[model samples]
Target: MLHKLELIDIKTHKITKIEFKKGLNVLHGDNGTGKSSVLEMIGFVLFDFLPENQADYVRETHSDKPEYGKVRVWITDIKGEPYIIERTVGKPGVIVKDALTKSRIPEIRGVNQLKAWIGRNILPMHEIELGKLFDSSIGIPQGTFINPFLRREGDRKAYFDPIMQLGVYEKVFKNLNELNKKFEPDVQGVSETIHEIIGEIKIKEELLQEQESLNAEIISLAKKLTKSESKSKGLKEKYKEIKKIKEQIDEAQKKLDELNIKSEKENENLIDMDSQLRDANTAKQICDETKEAYNKHIKLSSNLEILEQEFEKLNAYKEDLRINNENYIKESTHLKQLEEVLKKAETNKKKLPKLERIYQEHSELVNKIKEIEATIVEINAKEEQQVKLEEKASNISKNIKSLKETLVELPELVKKYNIMKDIELRIKEHEIDVANLTNQLEFFKNNQEKINQHKCPFVDQTCKNLGEGTFNEDIFNNKIKTKEISLQDIEKQIEKEKEEIHEKEIFREKMDILEKDKTTIENYKAQYRDYQDEIKALKEEVRIKPQVIKDKKE
Candidate 1:
């Protein structure tokens, strides 16, 4: 219910206030006295439409410069809560406020907000459009009731659809038709995919047949490889036996070489032994002479050792006597010094009380100084705290000033932020729309031919009724290119796997050969060690043979 309407400076006429009653109201006036202007203002405020120019509503009796005209409508909601809606003539915005709270309802800016506000607070959406609602139900315009009787049948039905609320059913049917159109393409694409899969199945069957033939050939090769491996194994065993025999022969040859070396060393040793035998008598004679001379030297050395021992005893006794004399001299000097020190101690004992008194005074003064220093340190700390507090207060003042300035601009900033947020929301909605379009494009590309063949159930043209646009052949070509790249990748992966398998087989064969070579090397190393041991023994025997012969000669 409209409780009040206030208008300012409206076309040489100003309506300051107009009040209405609860149930029924009437306005009757002369033709030029602005009777219809009130209804026009009501339509402009509520339904955002006016029969006359909004600028003409400006008062001509006002100042020469056009002044802003305003319309404020006060209405009661369904719950009887009062709301005030204000609009300025020739302005682009409206303001809605809670009359009780006097607080503005934010976000009521343009026609959409006004409509939504009216729907939520004053009337239902269909009733908020006063022209339509009045024409259809409550109040008929001058010619509206007679026009439908004169119209054609189709036109009459069209006019009646909104009155009977049959347009909603038409919208629902249209949406269902669009949904069916969208699904038809998907169904056709699926059918085409099934056909492609069937064709691939036939190709796979042929490949399987070829694979079976390859498997047979592989089995034949495997049998041949097994036979070759068996032959190689037998040959390796024979080679091993031959290697062992060769090692034995080499060992025998090494021993023969050692025997020959030993024989030659022994013959040389025989010659050296005979020469030593001849020199044996002469060496024994020389040894006897050296023994006689050694006995005389031993007797002389014993007499000299006895004399030297007696001389050392006499020298030790003299050294002891000299040490005693030096100690007696040191004791006499020390005793003299001690007597002098005793006299000095006696002299200093008289001054001990005075020194003790001075020390006590000095200790008292040191404690007093420390106490004074502690007090000074505490005072400095308080002064520093006072300085810090002053700085803090200055900072707080600056912050308060800044806060006041920010508060002044807060409303405008909030409004801008809201506008930016709305723009961001719109951008995000557009991004979502783009993403949906991209997905639809990709879908069509992936199934272009199939979608192209799909026909709309309601329309004769293929894909004509689709909610999304028709398939793009360029996108389909790109999808084919992508699939081709993927196929190439798969082929490369298969080839890489085959090469890896071949390399692994080659590595295994090499490992087998290495194992055999390692065994052969270990056997050879053991044989070489045995040969070295035999050579060492032969050399030792050759060295001792001459020693034995020399002992026998002796």
Candidate 2:
């Protein structure tokens, strides 16, 4: 059996020393002292129990606060040999020492090292008949776990029988008889073997208990499996219902897709109609612009013709002036010749002054003759110039009258060209516009039947209840609106838009009629201007008179 225990620096104590004696050593100390801790350390150092109480004296009172503590214990071995087991906190690990010399042992230097060392030296108290083999308060035995190894064979036999007689596993007859009394006290099986030992019978009963425990575990596991299978079946049924609902949703989606395709076809037709209408309007506008430009060009050409007539009249007046200039040149030549005669007369009058009155009178008569001759020459030249000027003036007047008549005709030609072109282009444009509008109107009319036949109803659900049916609109409207717009409101708005567009089309038609009437009036005005110009030019030509001149001497 084991002997003394000594504690140093172990739990709840700092540097406290304790000692124990052999056989029964009871330790008593106040709470928070090292008494129980000393018992725990001895049990660990000797029999490998109470590992947590190994030898650390310090621990963290709270996780946030820690105390570093160390512990060492002295225990006696089976032959009364002493050894020290030492432990410290804050990283230096376990240490085991020779008790007498206080020198450390190498093998017992880890946290679990002490457990292995003790297991080599000690038998657990429960495995032995601990109460009979060792003391209760302190576990040192009288003839304990150590004694079996130390004693002689005869001594060992004595220890074994006494312990065997007291334990749950004893001889067969004793155990069987005990069970028999408990189960059937007054009855005994006859002719059966009675040689079974009590210890063997007791072993058989232990086997039966083990089988009973195993059977109970099997039953519990089977019940759990059955519950799990039922739950699996219920979940499968729910999955099947969910699959059916998905199929219904898919069918609804396919129907909605067909409706959408029909609606798209209708929309395409409507779009084509709208595009055609816009193209027709554009063509009409282009034609009207072209006609207006042609009319403007015609007006400009008429103004150019009038300007040419005025230029021709100015040219004729220049020609008459040239003829009068020839008359002026002849008159100048006659005046020079008359001046020479008068100078000769003056000279003769100066030389014959001695002849008196006759010479002077003759000189005066010559001077008069010269002056009269100069006057006659001037008059004849004037007459000649007037005749040539009158002839030129008549030619100029004839040319002016001819030009006026041609100019009047030009205005009529320009007006006629403009009116005809305007009327022809306008008629062509109106025909094209009418064709386009008719095609567009026909397209819309043809598609309207298909659009009405295949309209899809929009469906929704308002609540999560299983029995509730889907919600939908009764009357379908083909137009798509913004998310915030109500469907019923859009249906009403569509009718109003249709009426407004129809009114615009009617107004366009009336404007086309007015344009045709304006073109006709313009043509009439051009023709009237041409006739008036021709009549006025003819009258001016008739009203002109010819020039005349009388003969004269030079």
Candidate 3:
């Protein structure tokens, strides 16, 4: 409730002040005595609006027109700070000032800052006609008339809805009660018994996994035994074949050594031809050197003849050049004297025209520049005054535009405010409904244990609805199977396989050595044959040079 209200310089009046009472108070007078405007003035100050046609809309739209629509309100604080709320209308912008400090308050749109201030600092008007409460008119006393608080068509569903919800609450309660009756002892015993059974099942599962891993290991070892048996048999057969081949090779080598000695005696004449071929090669090298020097002497004589011809040509050209030099010097001196006279004549010819054109252009441009500078100075002088007027005009125009916008927004503001009031009423009804629902929820929360443990008649269906307590055996079985492959069991199998691979690798290395031994034996047999041939050839060389061989022996 407003404690006091004052209107100052609002519309036609220069100044007006009014006071208000704390309790329910009405501002009343005959129809056109500015009584309605007083309410408008209160709205303007505390809420910011004025009735239509109370003030001239045109003059009010200018920012500088006047602060004629100012209103002030004084209120008591039941909560926090209280001050007179002042609002200025009929200006470009609305001004809301806190009376105590004289500082302006920020204007809030959509939500009322002034009303919120009152809510925080003073008692908010309590609303009793919550739409849902006592919704049916039958609840009211028959002939004791009640004040109309809202339109008859205003939604009253909130008052009737909770009555309908009692059925839902009844169903929830009946289910809960039945659930509790069947629960208690069975739930208490099963919870403990189920935990013990699950513990035993977990132990059994671990034992089953260990037994399965041992079985897998036994099977793997059996396969390894079968493969090892096969490889051992193959190695024995190859060893026998290698021994037999070695015997046959030994017999052949003995027969070849005997034949090699007879063949060397038949090849002794072929060795003597190589000595004659060496002397013929020495004579051919001496002949090649003597031919190269004879060609060098002939090339030097041809170069001497060319030099004699060039000497005669130089002697004739020198005499001709001496005669030309004397004539050139004489002509050059005469030409220089003529060139000097021509330059002087040309200089005088160019000076008069070039200077006259320069003076004419300079005189013209100097006069033109002076006129431009004077014009620039004149424009500069007026710039300051023009700027001042432009600033003033701009400020006035901006203020006028702002005032017009606020005036135009006035109707919208009232419409929004009314809509907001309706929303607040609806919200109050919802709050009551929510409070009732919360009370019902507390009843359920207080009985949770009984509900969770109840042997529901539709246990499966209840589980389906509640999404609880369904054990997936297939997923669990697959998981158990996966767990059966213990890491230790896998590591043991890996070690056995690695050991088998290592044994096979060693066997492969032995086979490789056997193959290399065969190659080395073959190469040694070939080298022995070559060494025998060289010994026979050296004996033949000693027979051909017997004296040299005899001297070496001495």
RMSD to true structure for each model, in Å: 36.2, 64.0, 43.0
Off by over 4 Å in 1: 62-65, 126-145, 169-554
**How would you encode candidate 3's per-residue C-alpha lDDT over 384-459 as one tens digit per residue?**
4445544554554555455454455445544554454444434444444444444334433323322354323223
TM-score of 1: 0.31
The better candidate by TM-score, 2 or 3, is 3
Predicted candidate 2 versus true structure: per-residue lDDT over 179-262, tens digit per residue: 888767334443233535666788999999999999999999999999999999999999999999999999999999999999
lDDT tens digits, residue span 1-554, model 1: 89999888766456668899988899877767766667777877887666567777877763474566888999888888999999888666588899999999876777666765575567765412444554455444445678777875544554554456555678889999999898998989999999999999999999999999999999999999999999999999999999999999999999999999999999999999999988997898887879988888899999999999999999999999999999999999999999999999998899899999999998987776666566555545554554555455455445545545445544554555445434433443343343334344444453565445664422334674344665353556676566556555544554554443444334434544554555555555555555555545544444444444444344
- TM values, all candidates: 0.31, 0.21, 0.22
**Worst ten in a row by lDDT for model 2:** 545-554
Instruction: For candidate 2, give the lDDT of residue 465.
Output: 29
Please give the lDDT score for candidate 3.
Answer: 0.54
**Which is better, 1 or 2, measured by TM-score?**
1
**Model 2 segments beyond 4 Å from truth?**
1-11, 51-67, 89-92, 101-103, 109-113, 122-554
* Predicted structure 3, TM vs. truth: 0.22
- Clash pairs of candidate 2? 171-198, 171-199, 172-197, 172-198, 172-199, 173-198
CA lDDT, candidate 1, residue 86: 90
